[model samples]
Structures are given as C-alpha cells and as structure tokens.
Target: MSFEDEWAECQKTANQRSTRMQLNQTPDGNYRPGRAPGGDLVVHDNELGAIGNEAYGLYQHLRTQGDEARPATFAAATAMTSSSLSLGSALYQVHDNWSTQLGSLKEACAHISNHLDYSQKRHKEDEARIATGMHTVSKLYDYFK
Candidate 1:
C-alpha cells in the first residue's frame, strides 16, 4: 500500500482505540460514578494497619532467616578460593548476587511497611483537617444567627 493509505489506516485505528470505553470511563468520556466524584475510597483503618504490621513482621522474619545462610555460604566460598579451585570464582559470584537480591527484598519489605504507615497517618490528618474546616464554617454561620 501507498504511504498515504498506510497513514489513513493508522489514523482510523488510533481513532477507534481512542473512542473505545475504558474500564473506569463511560462512552461519553466521563468517569463512572463509583470511580470518580461520587466514589468512596473507604479504607478500613484496622485493615490498613494490619497490612502495615504484616509487612513489618515479614521484614523482621526475612532479616534473620534470609541471612541465616550467609556465614555458611561465605565460608564455603572462602574455602574454595583458598584451595585455588575454579569453582571459587563461581561461588563468590553466587554469594555476591544472592546478597544483592536479599538486600533488595529487605528494602522492598521495609518500603511497603513505611508507605502503608505513612498513608494511614496522612489519611487521618486529612480527615482531621476537613473536620476542623467544617466546624469553623458551622461556627461562622452560628455567629451570624
């Protein structure tokens, strides 16, 4: 096909894709009620706290158990290296990679716990701010009475 034909076909495909209704959007391009203005983002405080606690527990477990093999693995690597065995290099590399991966996992667990905790605190602060604003507005109206 000519370049112009290909361009026209591409344009038609793009238009069709853009006009398709997405999961949270309606045919008229507005977000569905439960996902937008009228939606409730109700998160149970206890549930969020539980999740954060679970993440912290997992982090603690991994820190100890995951490193339980560290001494053995390093000892084996050192023995192999001192024996001038070709396997020494491979063992060391494995040890290094494993350490890196374990560190990443620990970091991820900690991040999850911290993020959840911060979210809970932020949500409570936002609620408090809104409540205070509403109370102030109510008092202003009463003063005018």
Candidate 2:
C-alpha cells in the first residue's frame, strides 16, 4: 500500500483506540490507578522556578554578549560606505539587516524571561489561594461532624 493509505489506516486505528481506555483501568468500573478519576493538572514549584531562572539567565546573557559584534559590524559598515567600491551599499544593507534581527532576538529573550517570571509568581498565588479555600472547607466539615 501507499504511504497515504498506511497513514489513514493508522489514524483510523488510533481513533478507535482513543474512544476506549487502553490502560490504567481494571475489569471493574472503578479506576485501579492511584491517580484521580478525571484528568489532573499538576505543576511543580521547583521545575517552574528553574525554567523562569533559566529564561532570565538567557535574557541576561543575550543582552550582554549578543551585541558584542555590533561595534565591529558598525565599523565595517561605515568603512564600506565610505569606500567607493560597488559592494559598499550592499555591505551596509547586510549590516542593517543583521542589527534588526539581533534586536528582535534580544526582545524575544527578554519577553520569555519576563513572561516566565510572571507565570511563576501567579502560579504561587493561585496555589496559596486554593490551599486556603480547601482548609476553610475542611474546617467547616469538621464543625458539621
């Protein structure tokens, strides 16, 4: 069979399997695994903190070192512009394009760092709020009992 036919067959099989629980289920109706019945969203504080830290580090590195070649590039472009060679204009254009791309990359790195830091802080606040609500609910239940 052709690649397309094989791919379609695979997709059909996947669709059929997806409709049923393939694993993590026992013969009984109850879930056998230690996990919750429905899908759960879990996040680790350390992992998120590490990602934010790494993004910030990358931002700092890019800000400090990514522009190291700017001076040389500018100087070369200036020299080429001053010269009467036919490639002078083209050289300056290349320099301009490089500078633009470098600036864009620097901005992207900063954005990633800032976004990750914000997400980490917001996640902490959300977790604290959830924990406080749960505790209050548990106390209410104890009083009722």
Candidate 3:
C-alpha cells in the first residue's frame, strides 16, 4: 500500500527465499547420494569416442586444408613488397599470425582428441577393475554364507 510497507514486504519475501548454494541437491533441499535431480557427471564411452573422433577429424581437416592459401598469400605479400607498397609488411604479418593461429587451433584439436581417447580408455579400465572387485566380494560373501 505505502512505499515503506511495499519495501518491507519485498525485503521479507527476499529474506524468505534461499540464497545458499545447493550443489547436487534435490528440489526439496535433500542431498541425494548417487544422483541428484540435476543428474550426475556421466560420460558414456560412445559419447567420448564420438567427441574424440570429431576432434580428430577436425584436426585432420585443418592439417590438410588450413594452409591452402599460404603460398598465394605469401606470394602476394612478397609482390606487394617488391612493388613498394607500404601494406606489404602488414600483409606478411597477417599471414604469419594466421599461420600461428591455425597451428594453435590444430594443436588444441589434437590435444582434445588425445585427451578424450585416453580418458575413455582409463574409464573402461577403472570400470573393469571395480567389477572384478565386486565379483570377488560377492564370491567371498557366498562362501561365508
């Protein structure tokens, strides 16, 4: 009704709302053990493999096609320098920068691909180890029974 009343009401409402971080919690503010409502970190083998393959594919494509304009660009830059154009040095710098950036992008892609492949392999090994341990535990439990 009044400005002071509205301000007090807004403050009360804001104070009633939660401001704490709710990491891996359910909607009712309970902490779920295995998976929360937001879900757990799940990376399937096929998903990892697909991402790695895509990264590798991108790297391969960049390696083969990224430098297609290098020769022409350099030649043009050189010709411009020979013709006494002031922008020749800038053009050459641009070409160099482009090459550097392309190399960096290719390296990044390769790294992503390799890292994902390694992670996938490691995950499978871990799962296998866990399964073996579980099976051994079950056998021991049955023997005791």
lDDT tens digits by residue: candidate 2, 70-134: 77777776787788666767777777887788788878877877887788788668767865775
Top lDDT prediction, candidate number? 3
**Which candidate do you rate higher for lDDT, 1 or 3?**
3
What's model 1's TM-score? 0.66
How much lDDT does each candidate structure score? 0.77, 0.69, 0.82
* Model 3 bad stretches (over 4 Å): 1-41, 137-145
RMSD (CA, angstroms), candidate 2: 14.3
Tell me the lDDT of candidate 3.
Answer: 0.82
lDDT of 2 at 100: 89
The per-prediction CA RMSD against the true structure, in angstroms, equals 14.6, 14.3, 13.9
Per-residue C-alpha lDDT of model 3 across residues 64-105, encoded as one tens digit per residue: 999999888999999999999988899999899999999999
Q: If scored against the real structure, what TM-score would every candidate get?
A: 0.66, 0.61, 0.66
